[model samples]
Target chain A: MRILEIENLKKSYTTPDGEILTVIDVPGFALESGEQIALSGESGSGKTTFLNLVAGILRPDGGRIFLGGEDVTALSEAARDRLRADKIGYIFQTFNLLQGYTALENVLLGMMFGKGADKGFALGLLERVGLGDRAGYKPSQLSVGQQQRVALARALANRPALVLADEPTGNLDPGTAGKAVSLIKEMCAESGAALLLVSHDDKVLGNFGGVKDLGEINRAPRGGIEK
Target chain B: MNRENVGGIFLIAKKSLAQHRLSTVITVLSVALAAGLVMAVFSIRDQTYDAFTGGPAGFDAVLGARGSQLQLVLNTVFHLETSPGNIPWEMYEAIKENPNVELAVPYAVGDNYRGYRIVGTERSLFTDLEYRKGRKLTLAEGELFNPEKREAVVGSYVADKTGLKAGSKFNPFHGLVFDERQKHAEEYTVTGVLEPTNSPSDRVIWIPIDEFYRISGHVLRGGGGTYEPRAGEEIPDRYKEVSAVMLKLRNPQAGFLLDQTINRQGTAATLAWPIGRVMAELFGKIGWVNNVLSLVAYLVVLVAAGSILASIYNTMNERRREFAILRALGARRGTVFAAIILESASIAAIGAALGYAVYALILAGAAVVIRAETGVVLDVLKPGPALLAAPLAMIALGILAGVIPALKAYSTDVASNLAPLS
Candidate 1:
């Protein structure tokens, strides 16, 4: 089954200098369940904007987005949020765990907004990620690699149909970067969720089975600006 | 939203409060102080009014030798202040015989026994008087003093403080204040100890009028100093003058008639009727003090509310990323807004609940001071409007304080704020 399908997805912004910049214009994209793909792009090439539009974080200027075969374009803002929360999980370049919450609590926080929080399931997920003992540790207390592993666990917490990994290993060293991409792909396949991982680093993309370059696929002006 | 899901918002708010524990605690303390002060001030004001206006119970008016009515009530009823001259015995007899009079009790004050005033009166003061409505002045120990004897009735507080129970004997001092060398030659025996009246009468030492007259220097140092008679001769009625007369009329209207007859026509005495009005007037004059304290309490509540606002508002700049993270996690904008407001309201609710303890402390202190000064025991546990309103008002102010910060949180930009910090 196709987990995500998009057509003519477009997004742009007006510069304060009175110039309109077309940041993203994608003709077509589709990913089947359990399929893992990497979309590589240069810096400031609208890579994050494409992922944001797919995740429903940024509304498209024009186009239709279907996630798990449901038309996402027709949903209200709140409904889009619900759809995003219930059906998609996002992994940020930086491990974006709430600093105040413990590793276990961060996992539960992901479930809090979706499936009602289950302490037993959240603990099991942490145990599977080999951080069982560190469940009580806060994000600040964990090392860089451990924090990223925790973030990966949080993304799959809701068992969403689609997972969007934006530069998942951007902040890691070359050695840790190789391991993180493998762990993300293995977890996504185990959960049977389609993975759309984006990155600017070639070595990070080299670990993936199939890679698509955002610069070639995206029909939009480059170097407009990256927020 | 499911009930379990609703807890996520509360959880975020509660942990955020814990994260900023110092500010939360200080805000709670300030709110507690303001709420407590508000409750204490109004309680003390109310109990005081009840005690003062209630005056030495059962008497509608005080008749004294021409002078300040407040002075006469203070001296005659409360046992404070010096006697304002003295009314002659004939004048007392005439009022006692008046048709409007239900009861006329004469009191002559000249001396003290260890700082407690010695009020000379008839035995009827104990048998016929009501300390409070329908509550007679009953003996807690022994019997009433004999009218012709040098026996005395010690009020509850006098017994407690001076260790003067029934059968105890004490020498009277020459004046109202205590001085060892100035003790009178004769000693008066305490025949009884009165029960707790919760009024000024609970602090007096009562003796018979005839015996008070015969006390050695009283004849010579009398109200209008009279000629000293020989040792064995009885003091004449013409020479015997009472300091004031406390009158209880048959009807409330009788006080007006007595006031008109004595104050306007009689000329020999001043009648202070409906003693409540006099007390109310006194409260009205000193009311500004209450107003000032109330203003201060109000200002603290405002400042505490400001503190809540500033505390939450200050943290908004740092937590934009946090809100954006939650927003990206499927938490609604309203969820973030509610969390901020919930935090503020929680601080106030906790503070207001704790404020009752503060109220208890303040009121207990005020009760002690008031009781010592006026013998009016305040009920510290008594609830008032401020006690109920102050806390709720603080919570409302807290919610009001939360709005500006919550609005900031609600308007956070996800795409911009969610960017990883370098």
Candidate 2:
């Protein structure tokens, strides 16, 4: 079954010049459960915008987005938020770990919005990410690779059906990036969660089972201008 | 939300506050200072009221020469002022014999011992006078004065200062001053020292009313030179006078009737003033000052609330990204809003605790000073309405202050915040 499906998705932004800039226009897209796919794009190609749309953080100008068999576009903002919290996991390129919380607390934070969050389960995820010993360390105290691993642990902590990772290995060295990518894929596979990874780096894209370029799928012009 | 989620939210707020140590301490201490000032004022106001109303226990009315009623109570009861003038001794005897009177204690005031007022009354002043409700005077070391002899019972404070004990003899000064030539020829031996009553009575020396009349300077000035008695000579009974008569009525309702009778029917007329009404009027005259003080205290609390608002509001810009991150992590906007509000409330709660601590310390110090200076014991632990209201009001104000910042956090755009990452 498809964990995520999008039909005629559209989004736009208005410029200071009073011209409408369409940032995303996708005719169709689908991702099967338990599948991992890479989404590649250059800067400003609406890769992040598509991810935000799927996560219900931003409203699409026009579209039908199905996640875990529920129509996201038909839901209210609040209902979409509840749906996202229950079914979707997002990993930012910046790691975006709360600076005030410890590594273990960051993982626990993902499960807080959902019912029946377990502390031992959060600890298990941290152990799986090789951060069990560093659970008490804050994000600032961890290296870039460790912080990214903590973020990956937190993303999978809620056991969501799909994970959208935007440049998960962007800030790491090549060796650490390969290890982080493997960990993300391995953790998602273990949880039976589909992965939609966004990256500009071909080396990072090479590790995924399938690949799609935003330039082809997004019908919007390169500079958010009409053709 | 589940229990875990609530605990997690509190943990986040605690960690967030800890992350900004200096700002948290500054905000908390400012609140503490404001609360402390308010509590201190309330405590002092309560102590002052207690001192005024509770000092003149057991006495219903004061009958003295026509003058300021408050002055009469102050002079006869608290020993705080000089006598206005004396009523004739015959008038006191007439009032003492009245059917409505329960106890009538006459006072003869004209002399001082080293600045401490020397009061002349019957021995009943010791055995009958009541200070703080039902508490009669007791001798700490010696015996009560003998009514027929030249003996004195010094108050605790007079004894403590002058080292006067039983059997110590001293000559009384003519008036409040200490001129050697003005010292009366008659001498009185201290027979007792009363225990500390924590009232103005602690600072006086009591002598017999008969001996008081015999003192050379006791003769009324306008009663003619024939009333003057030579040293060691006996004075005529018609020359005798007493400063005031403190009456405790059999039925407090009879005070008004007795007051009318004293002013209208006595051989030598006097005014009977109800002590409580006189005190209430005195308090009413100065009540506005307390209101103004209380207003200033509440304003301090308002300013403290502003500090909480400013403290949280100033940091809201930097916290937008943090809130955005929480939203992206599946936290509802309500969670973010609640966290901000809870953070401000936590600061206020802690500040109020510290404020009460500081208030207790201040009251402890003030109690010592008040007891030493005015002989009025302040009960620091006495609970008043302001005790509960002050801190609760502080927290309510704190929540109000948090609203502005919480609203800002709630409206933060997550997609815009995460755009830079892409």
Clashes of each: 0, 0
lDDT of 1 by residue, A1-227 (tens): 88889999888888788888888888988888888999988778888788878878778999889998888887887777777778888999987889999999888887888877888988887887889999999999999999998998888888889999988898899999999889988888898888999998898888887899887788887854766
Give per-residue lDDT, candidate 2, residue B212.
82
Candidate 2 per-residue lDDT, tens place, A1-227, comes to 99999999999888889888888999999999999999999878888888999998888999899998889999987787777777888999999898988998888877887644678998999899998999999999999999999999888888999999998888999999999999999999999999999999999999976999999999998783322
Candidate 1: regions farther than 4 A off: A69-71, B174-182, B220-236, B420-422
TM-scores of the models, in the order given: 0.92, 0.92
lDDT of 1 at A98: 96
The C-alpha interface RMSD of every prediction is: 2.5, 3.8
Collision pairs in model 1: none
Chain B superposition TM-score per model = 0.92, 0.88
TM-score for the B chain of model 2: 0.88
Instruction: Name the DockQ score for candidate 2.
Output: 0.46
Which 10 consecutive positions of candidate 1 chain B have the poorest summed lDDT?
A: B220-229
Candidate 1 displacement at residue B31 in angstroms:
1.4
